[model samples]
Target: MTINAGRHFVTIDESAAGERLDRALAAALPALTRSRVKALIEGRRVALAGGQTIEEPSRKVKTGERFEVDIPEPEPAEPVPQALALDILYEDGDLLVLNKPAGMVVHPAPGNPDSTLVNALLAHCGNSLSGIGGVRRPGIVHRLDKDTSGVMVVAKNDRTHVALSKLFAAHDLTRIYQALVWGAPKADRGRVEAAIGRHPVDRKRMAVRKSSGRNAITDYWIEKRFGPPLHPIASLVGARLGTGRTHQVRVHLAHLGCPVVGDPVYGRKSRNAKAPAALVDFARQALHAAVLEFRHPTTGEEMRFATELPQDFSKLVQSLNSVK
Candidate 1:
């Protein structure tokens, strides 16, 4: 079966103004993945005013600006019989890119084998999967945190799998993320160069340490600021990634004292005496895999994909806006 998606046109309104291009698309088209959105922008399928094309998914969209996109209609994936829904952004013979929602595990483990991305892919792709890193992941080239919803790329064949894996390992593949931080950043765009490693105290967490671990870098920009102690609500921040490491963006952002909103594990206690009542209510970490860009394995074409903020996140932002 052959799947061919279509093109979509979108306009930025007041509600979507200041949002990252990739993020707006993700929310606008829930079926498409973030990675696919970025690919479309990079491949010249996405146009911003005057037929001008954009390659940067993190580019901010102004109010009333119009943009165009091409969305693919994928073929009928072989039936494996799993009812789990998927946000497929782009698909072709050798690769697949998707926007994974928060709280959904990417792969199956001993305890979580039934409702994972792997299970859904198995059902959707059938026998067209390429094994990667052994049995744990069949076609998965990369993964996202269970609580982090964003873009992820997968391989459909062995050749594509090997090539994509090498690109990621060598840091050739570009990945960027957006996070809603509690505090404001000092600079609009600069590098947060730090070394990260497993937490010295916690076995499951990653931390920024003075010694040990690999190099990590994150860049951020302030999209909007709120709350003057006399007004209402809080602030919303945007960020981009320079390196792809385990929790690199999160840890670095937190290290700067601007931990993502609703991050129970790493976030500081709320400033407000009664914090849950605020406009923005984040039950989980407010982080998203906004964009993914790389060279296509089959066609050797450059591709990028992006996803927008989920409904829950969007609601929270609106609530915050209303508090003025």
Candidate 2:
């Protein structure tokens, strides 16, 4: 196996016999993701020893098969720069922290093709963006759901991106969220230690399954209660993540029988019946990334940020209190 210039040449050994072409390529080239390998194959940049192009990603390969993949130069991002307003909290050469509002898509996808955070960042940062991830996702380090409003940090360069990613992977950063839940927990504060994975029946949803799931932990405490003291209709809770997973806080809260208010997927509509009309009318999940703390990747200085609830959320809470 040899790598020269931008091309990779590999001869499959017995260990890789009968593996799919994409899988073999991914295994051989640790730098490229499986999706990237598939893209290369589909683009006709991959060929066998005799220049036989293999377009199918799932094609089986035999031992001693030789192949070469012509790595193409990365194409520029297609998302047009849109001069959208951004709520920047902090900015530097290494990274930028901003408050992502609800209803704003972080990146472009099938349903959302324009006016995303990436597009806005491209306009704001201009050419000073990291291309390590991909052209489409230039400076993205981590992601918050489109509807989950809160503070997020975007990397400005590859060095900062890698550093921030390592911090998140090690759970060395502080991420505190506030949520309005449908029900109050029996205890004032507790921890939900469970495993989370994709739902078996509904592939679009996440589930808390002890088996075939990744470890997830969430620590939550009741900040305030709404409705009667004995039987509250809702409760404001503070959640701190112990492990970051897809919908970890939501899934763990749902597992505790207290789904987030207005969470269309995991929430129970029946629970809304007892709540104030204003609370029920709230759209999207009543979850906010209220606080974020981490060490600066470049300066190594401890940085912390906090944000108040959005106007809508604050108004809803006020409405809940006014309910007789």
Per-residue CA lDDT of model 1 for 1-324, tens digit only, reads 222455567888899999999999877777667787887776545665434456689999998888767553442332233658898999988988999999888776545555788878888987788876456578888889888999999999899899998888888877877777775676656678898765654424678867556688777777776555443234566666666777787788888877888786677656764344643356888888888989987788989888888888777766665443
Local distance difference test scores for all models: 0.74, 0.85
Instruction: Give per-residue lDDT, candidate 1, residue 232.
Output: 23
Clashing pairs in 2: none
Tell me the TM-score of each prediction against the true structure: 0.70, 0.78
For candidate 1, the per-residue lDDT at 28 reads 76
Model 1 poorest ten-residue lDDT run: 72-81
* lDDT per residue as tens, model 2, 1-324: 433436678899999999999999899988888998999888666777544456789999999999878785544447888999999999999899999999998887767778999999999999988877577888998788888989999999989989998999999999999999987988999999998765654545778875556788899999999887878888899999998988888888989998999899898664545666677778889999999999998888999999999888888887787543
Candidate 1 global TM-score: 0.70
Query: How many collisions between residues are there in candidate 2?
Result: 0
Best by lDDT: 2
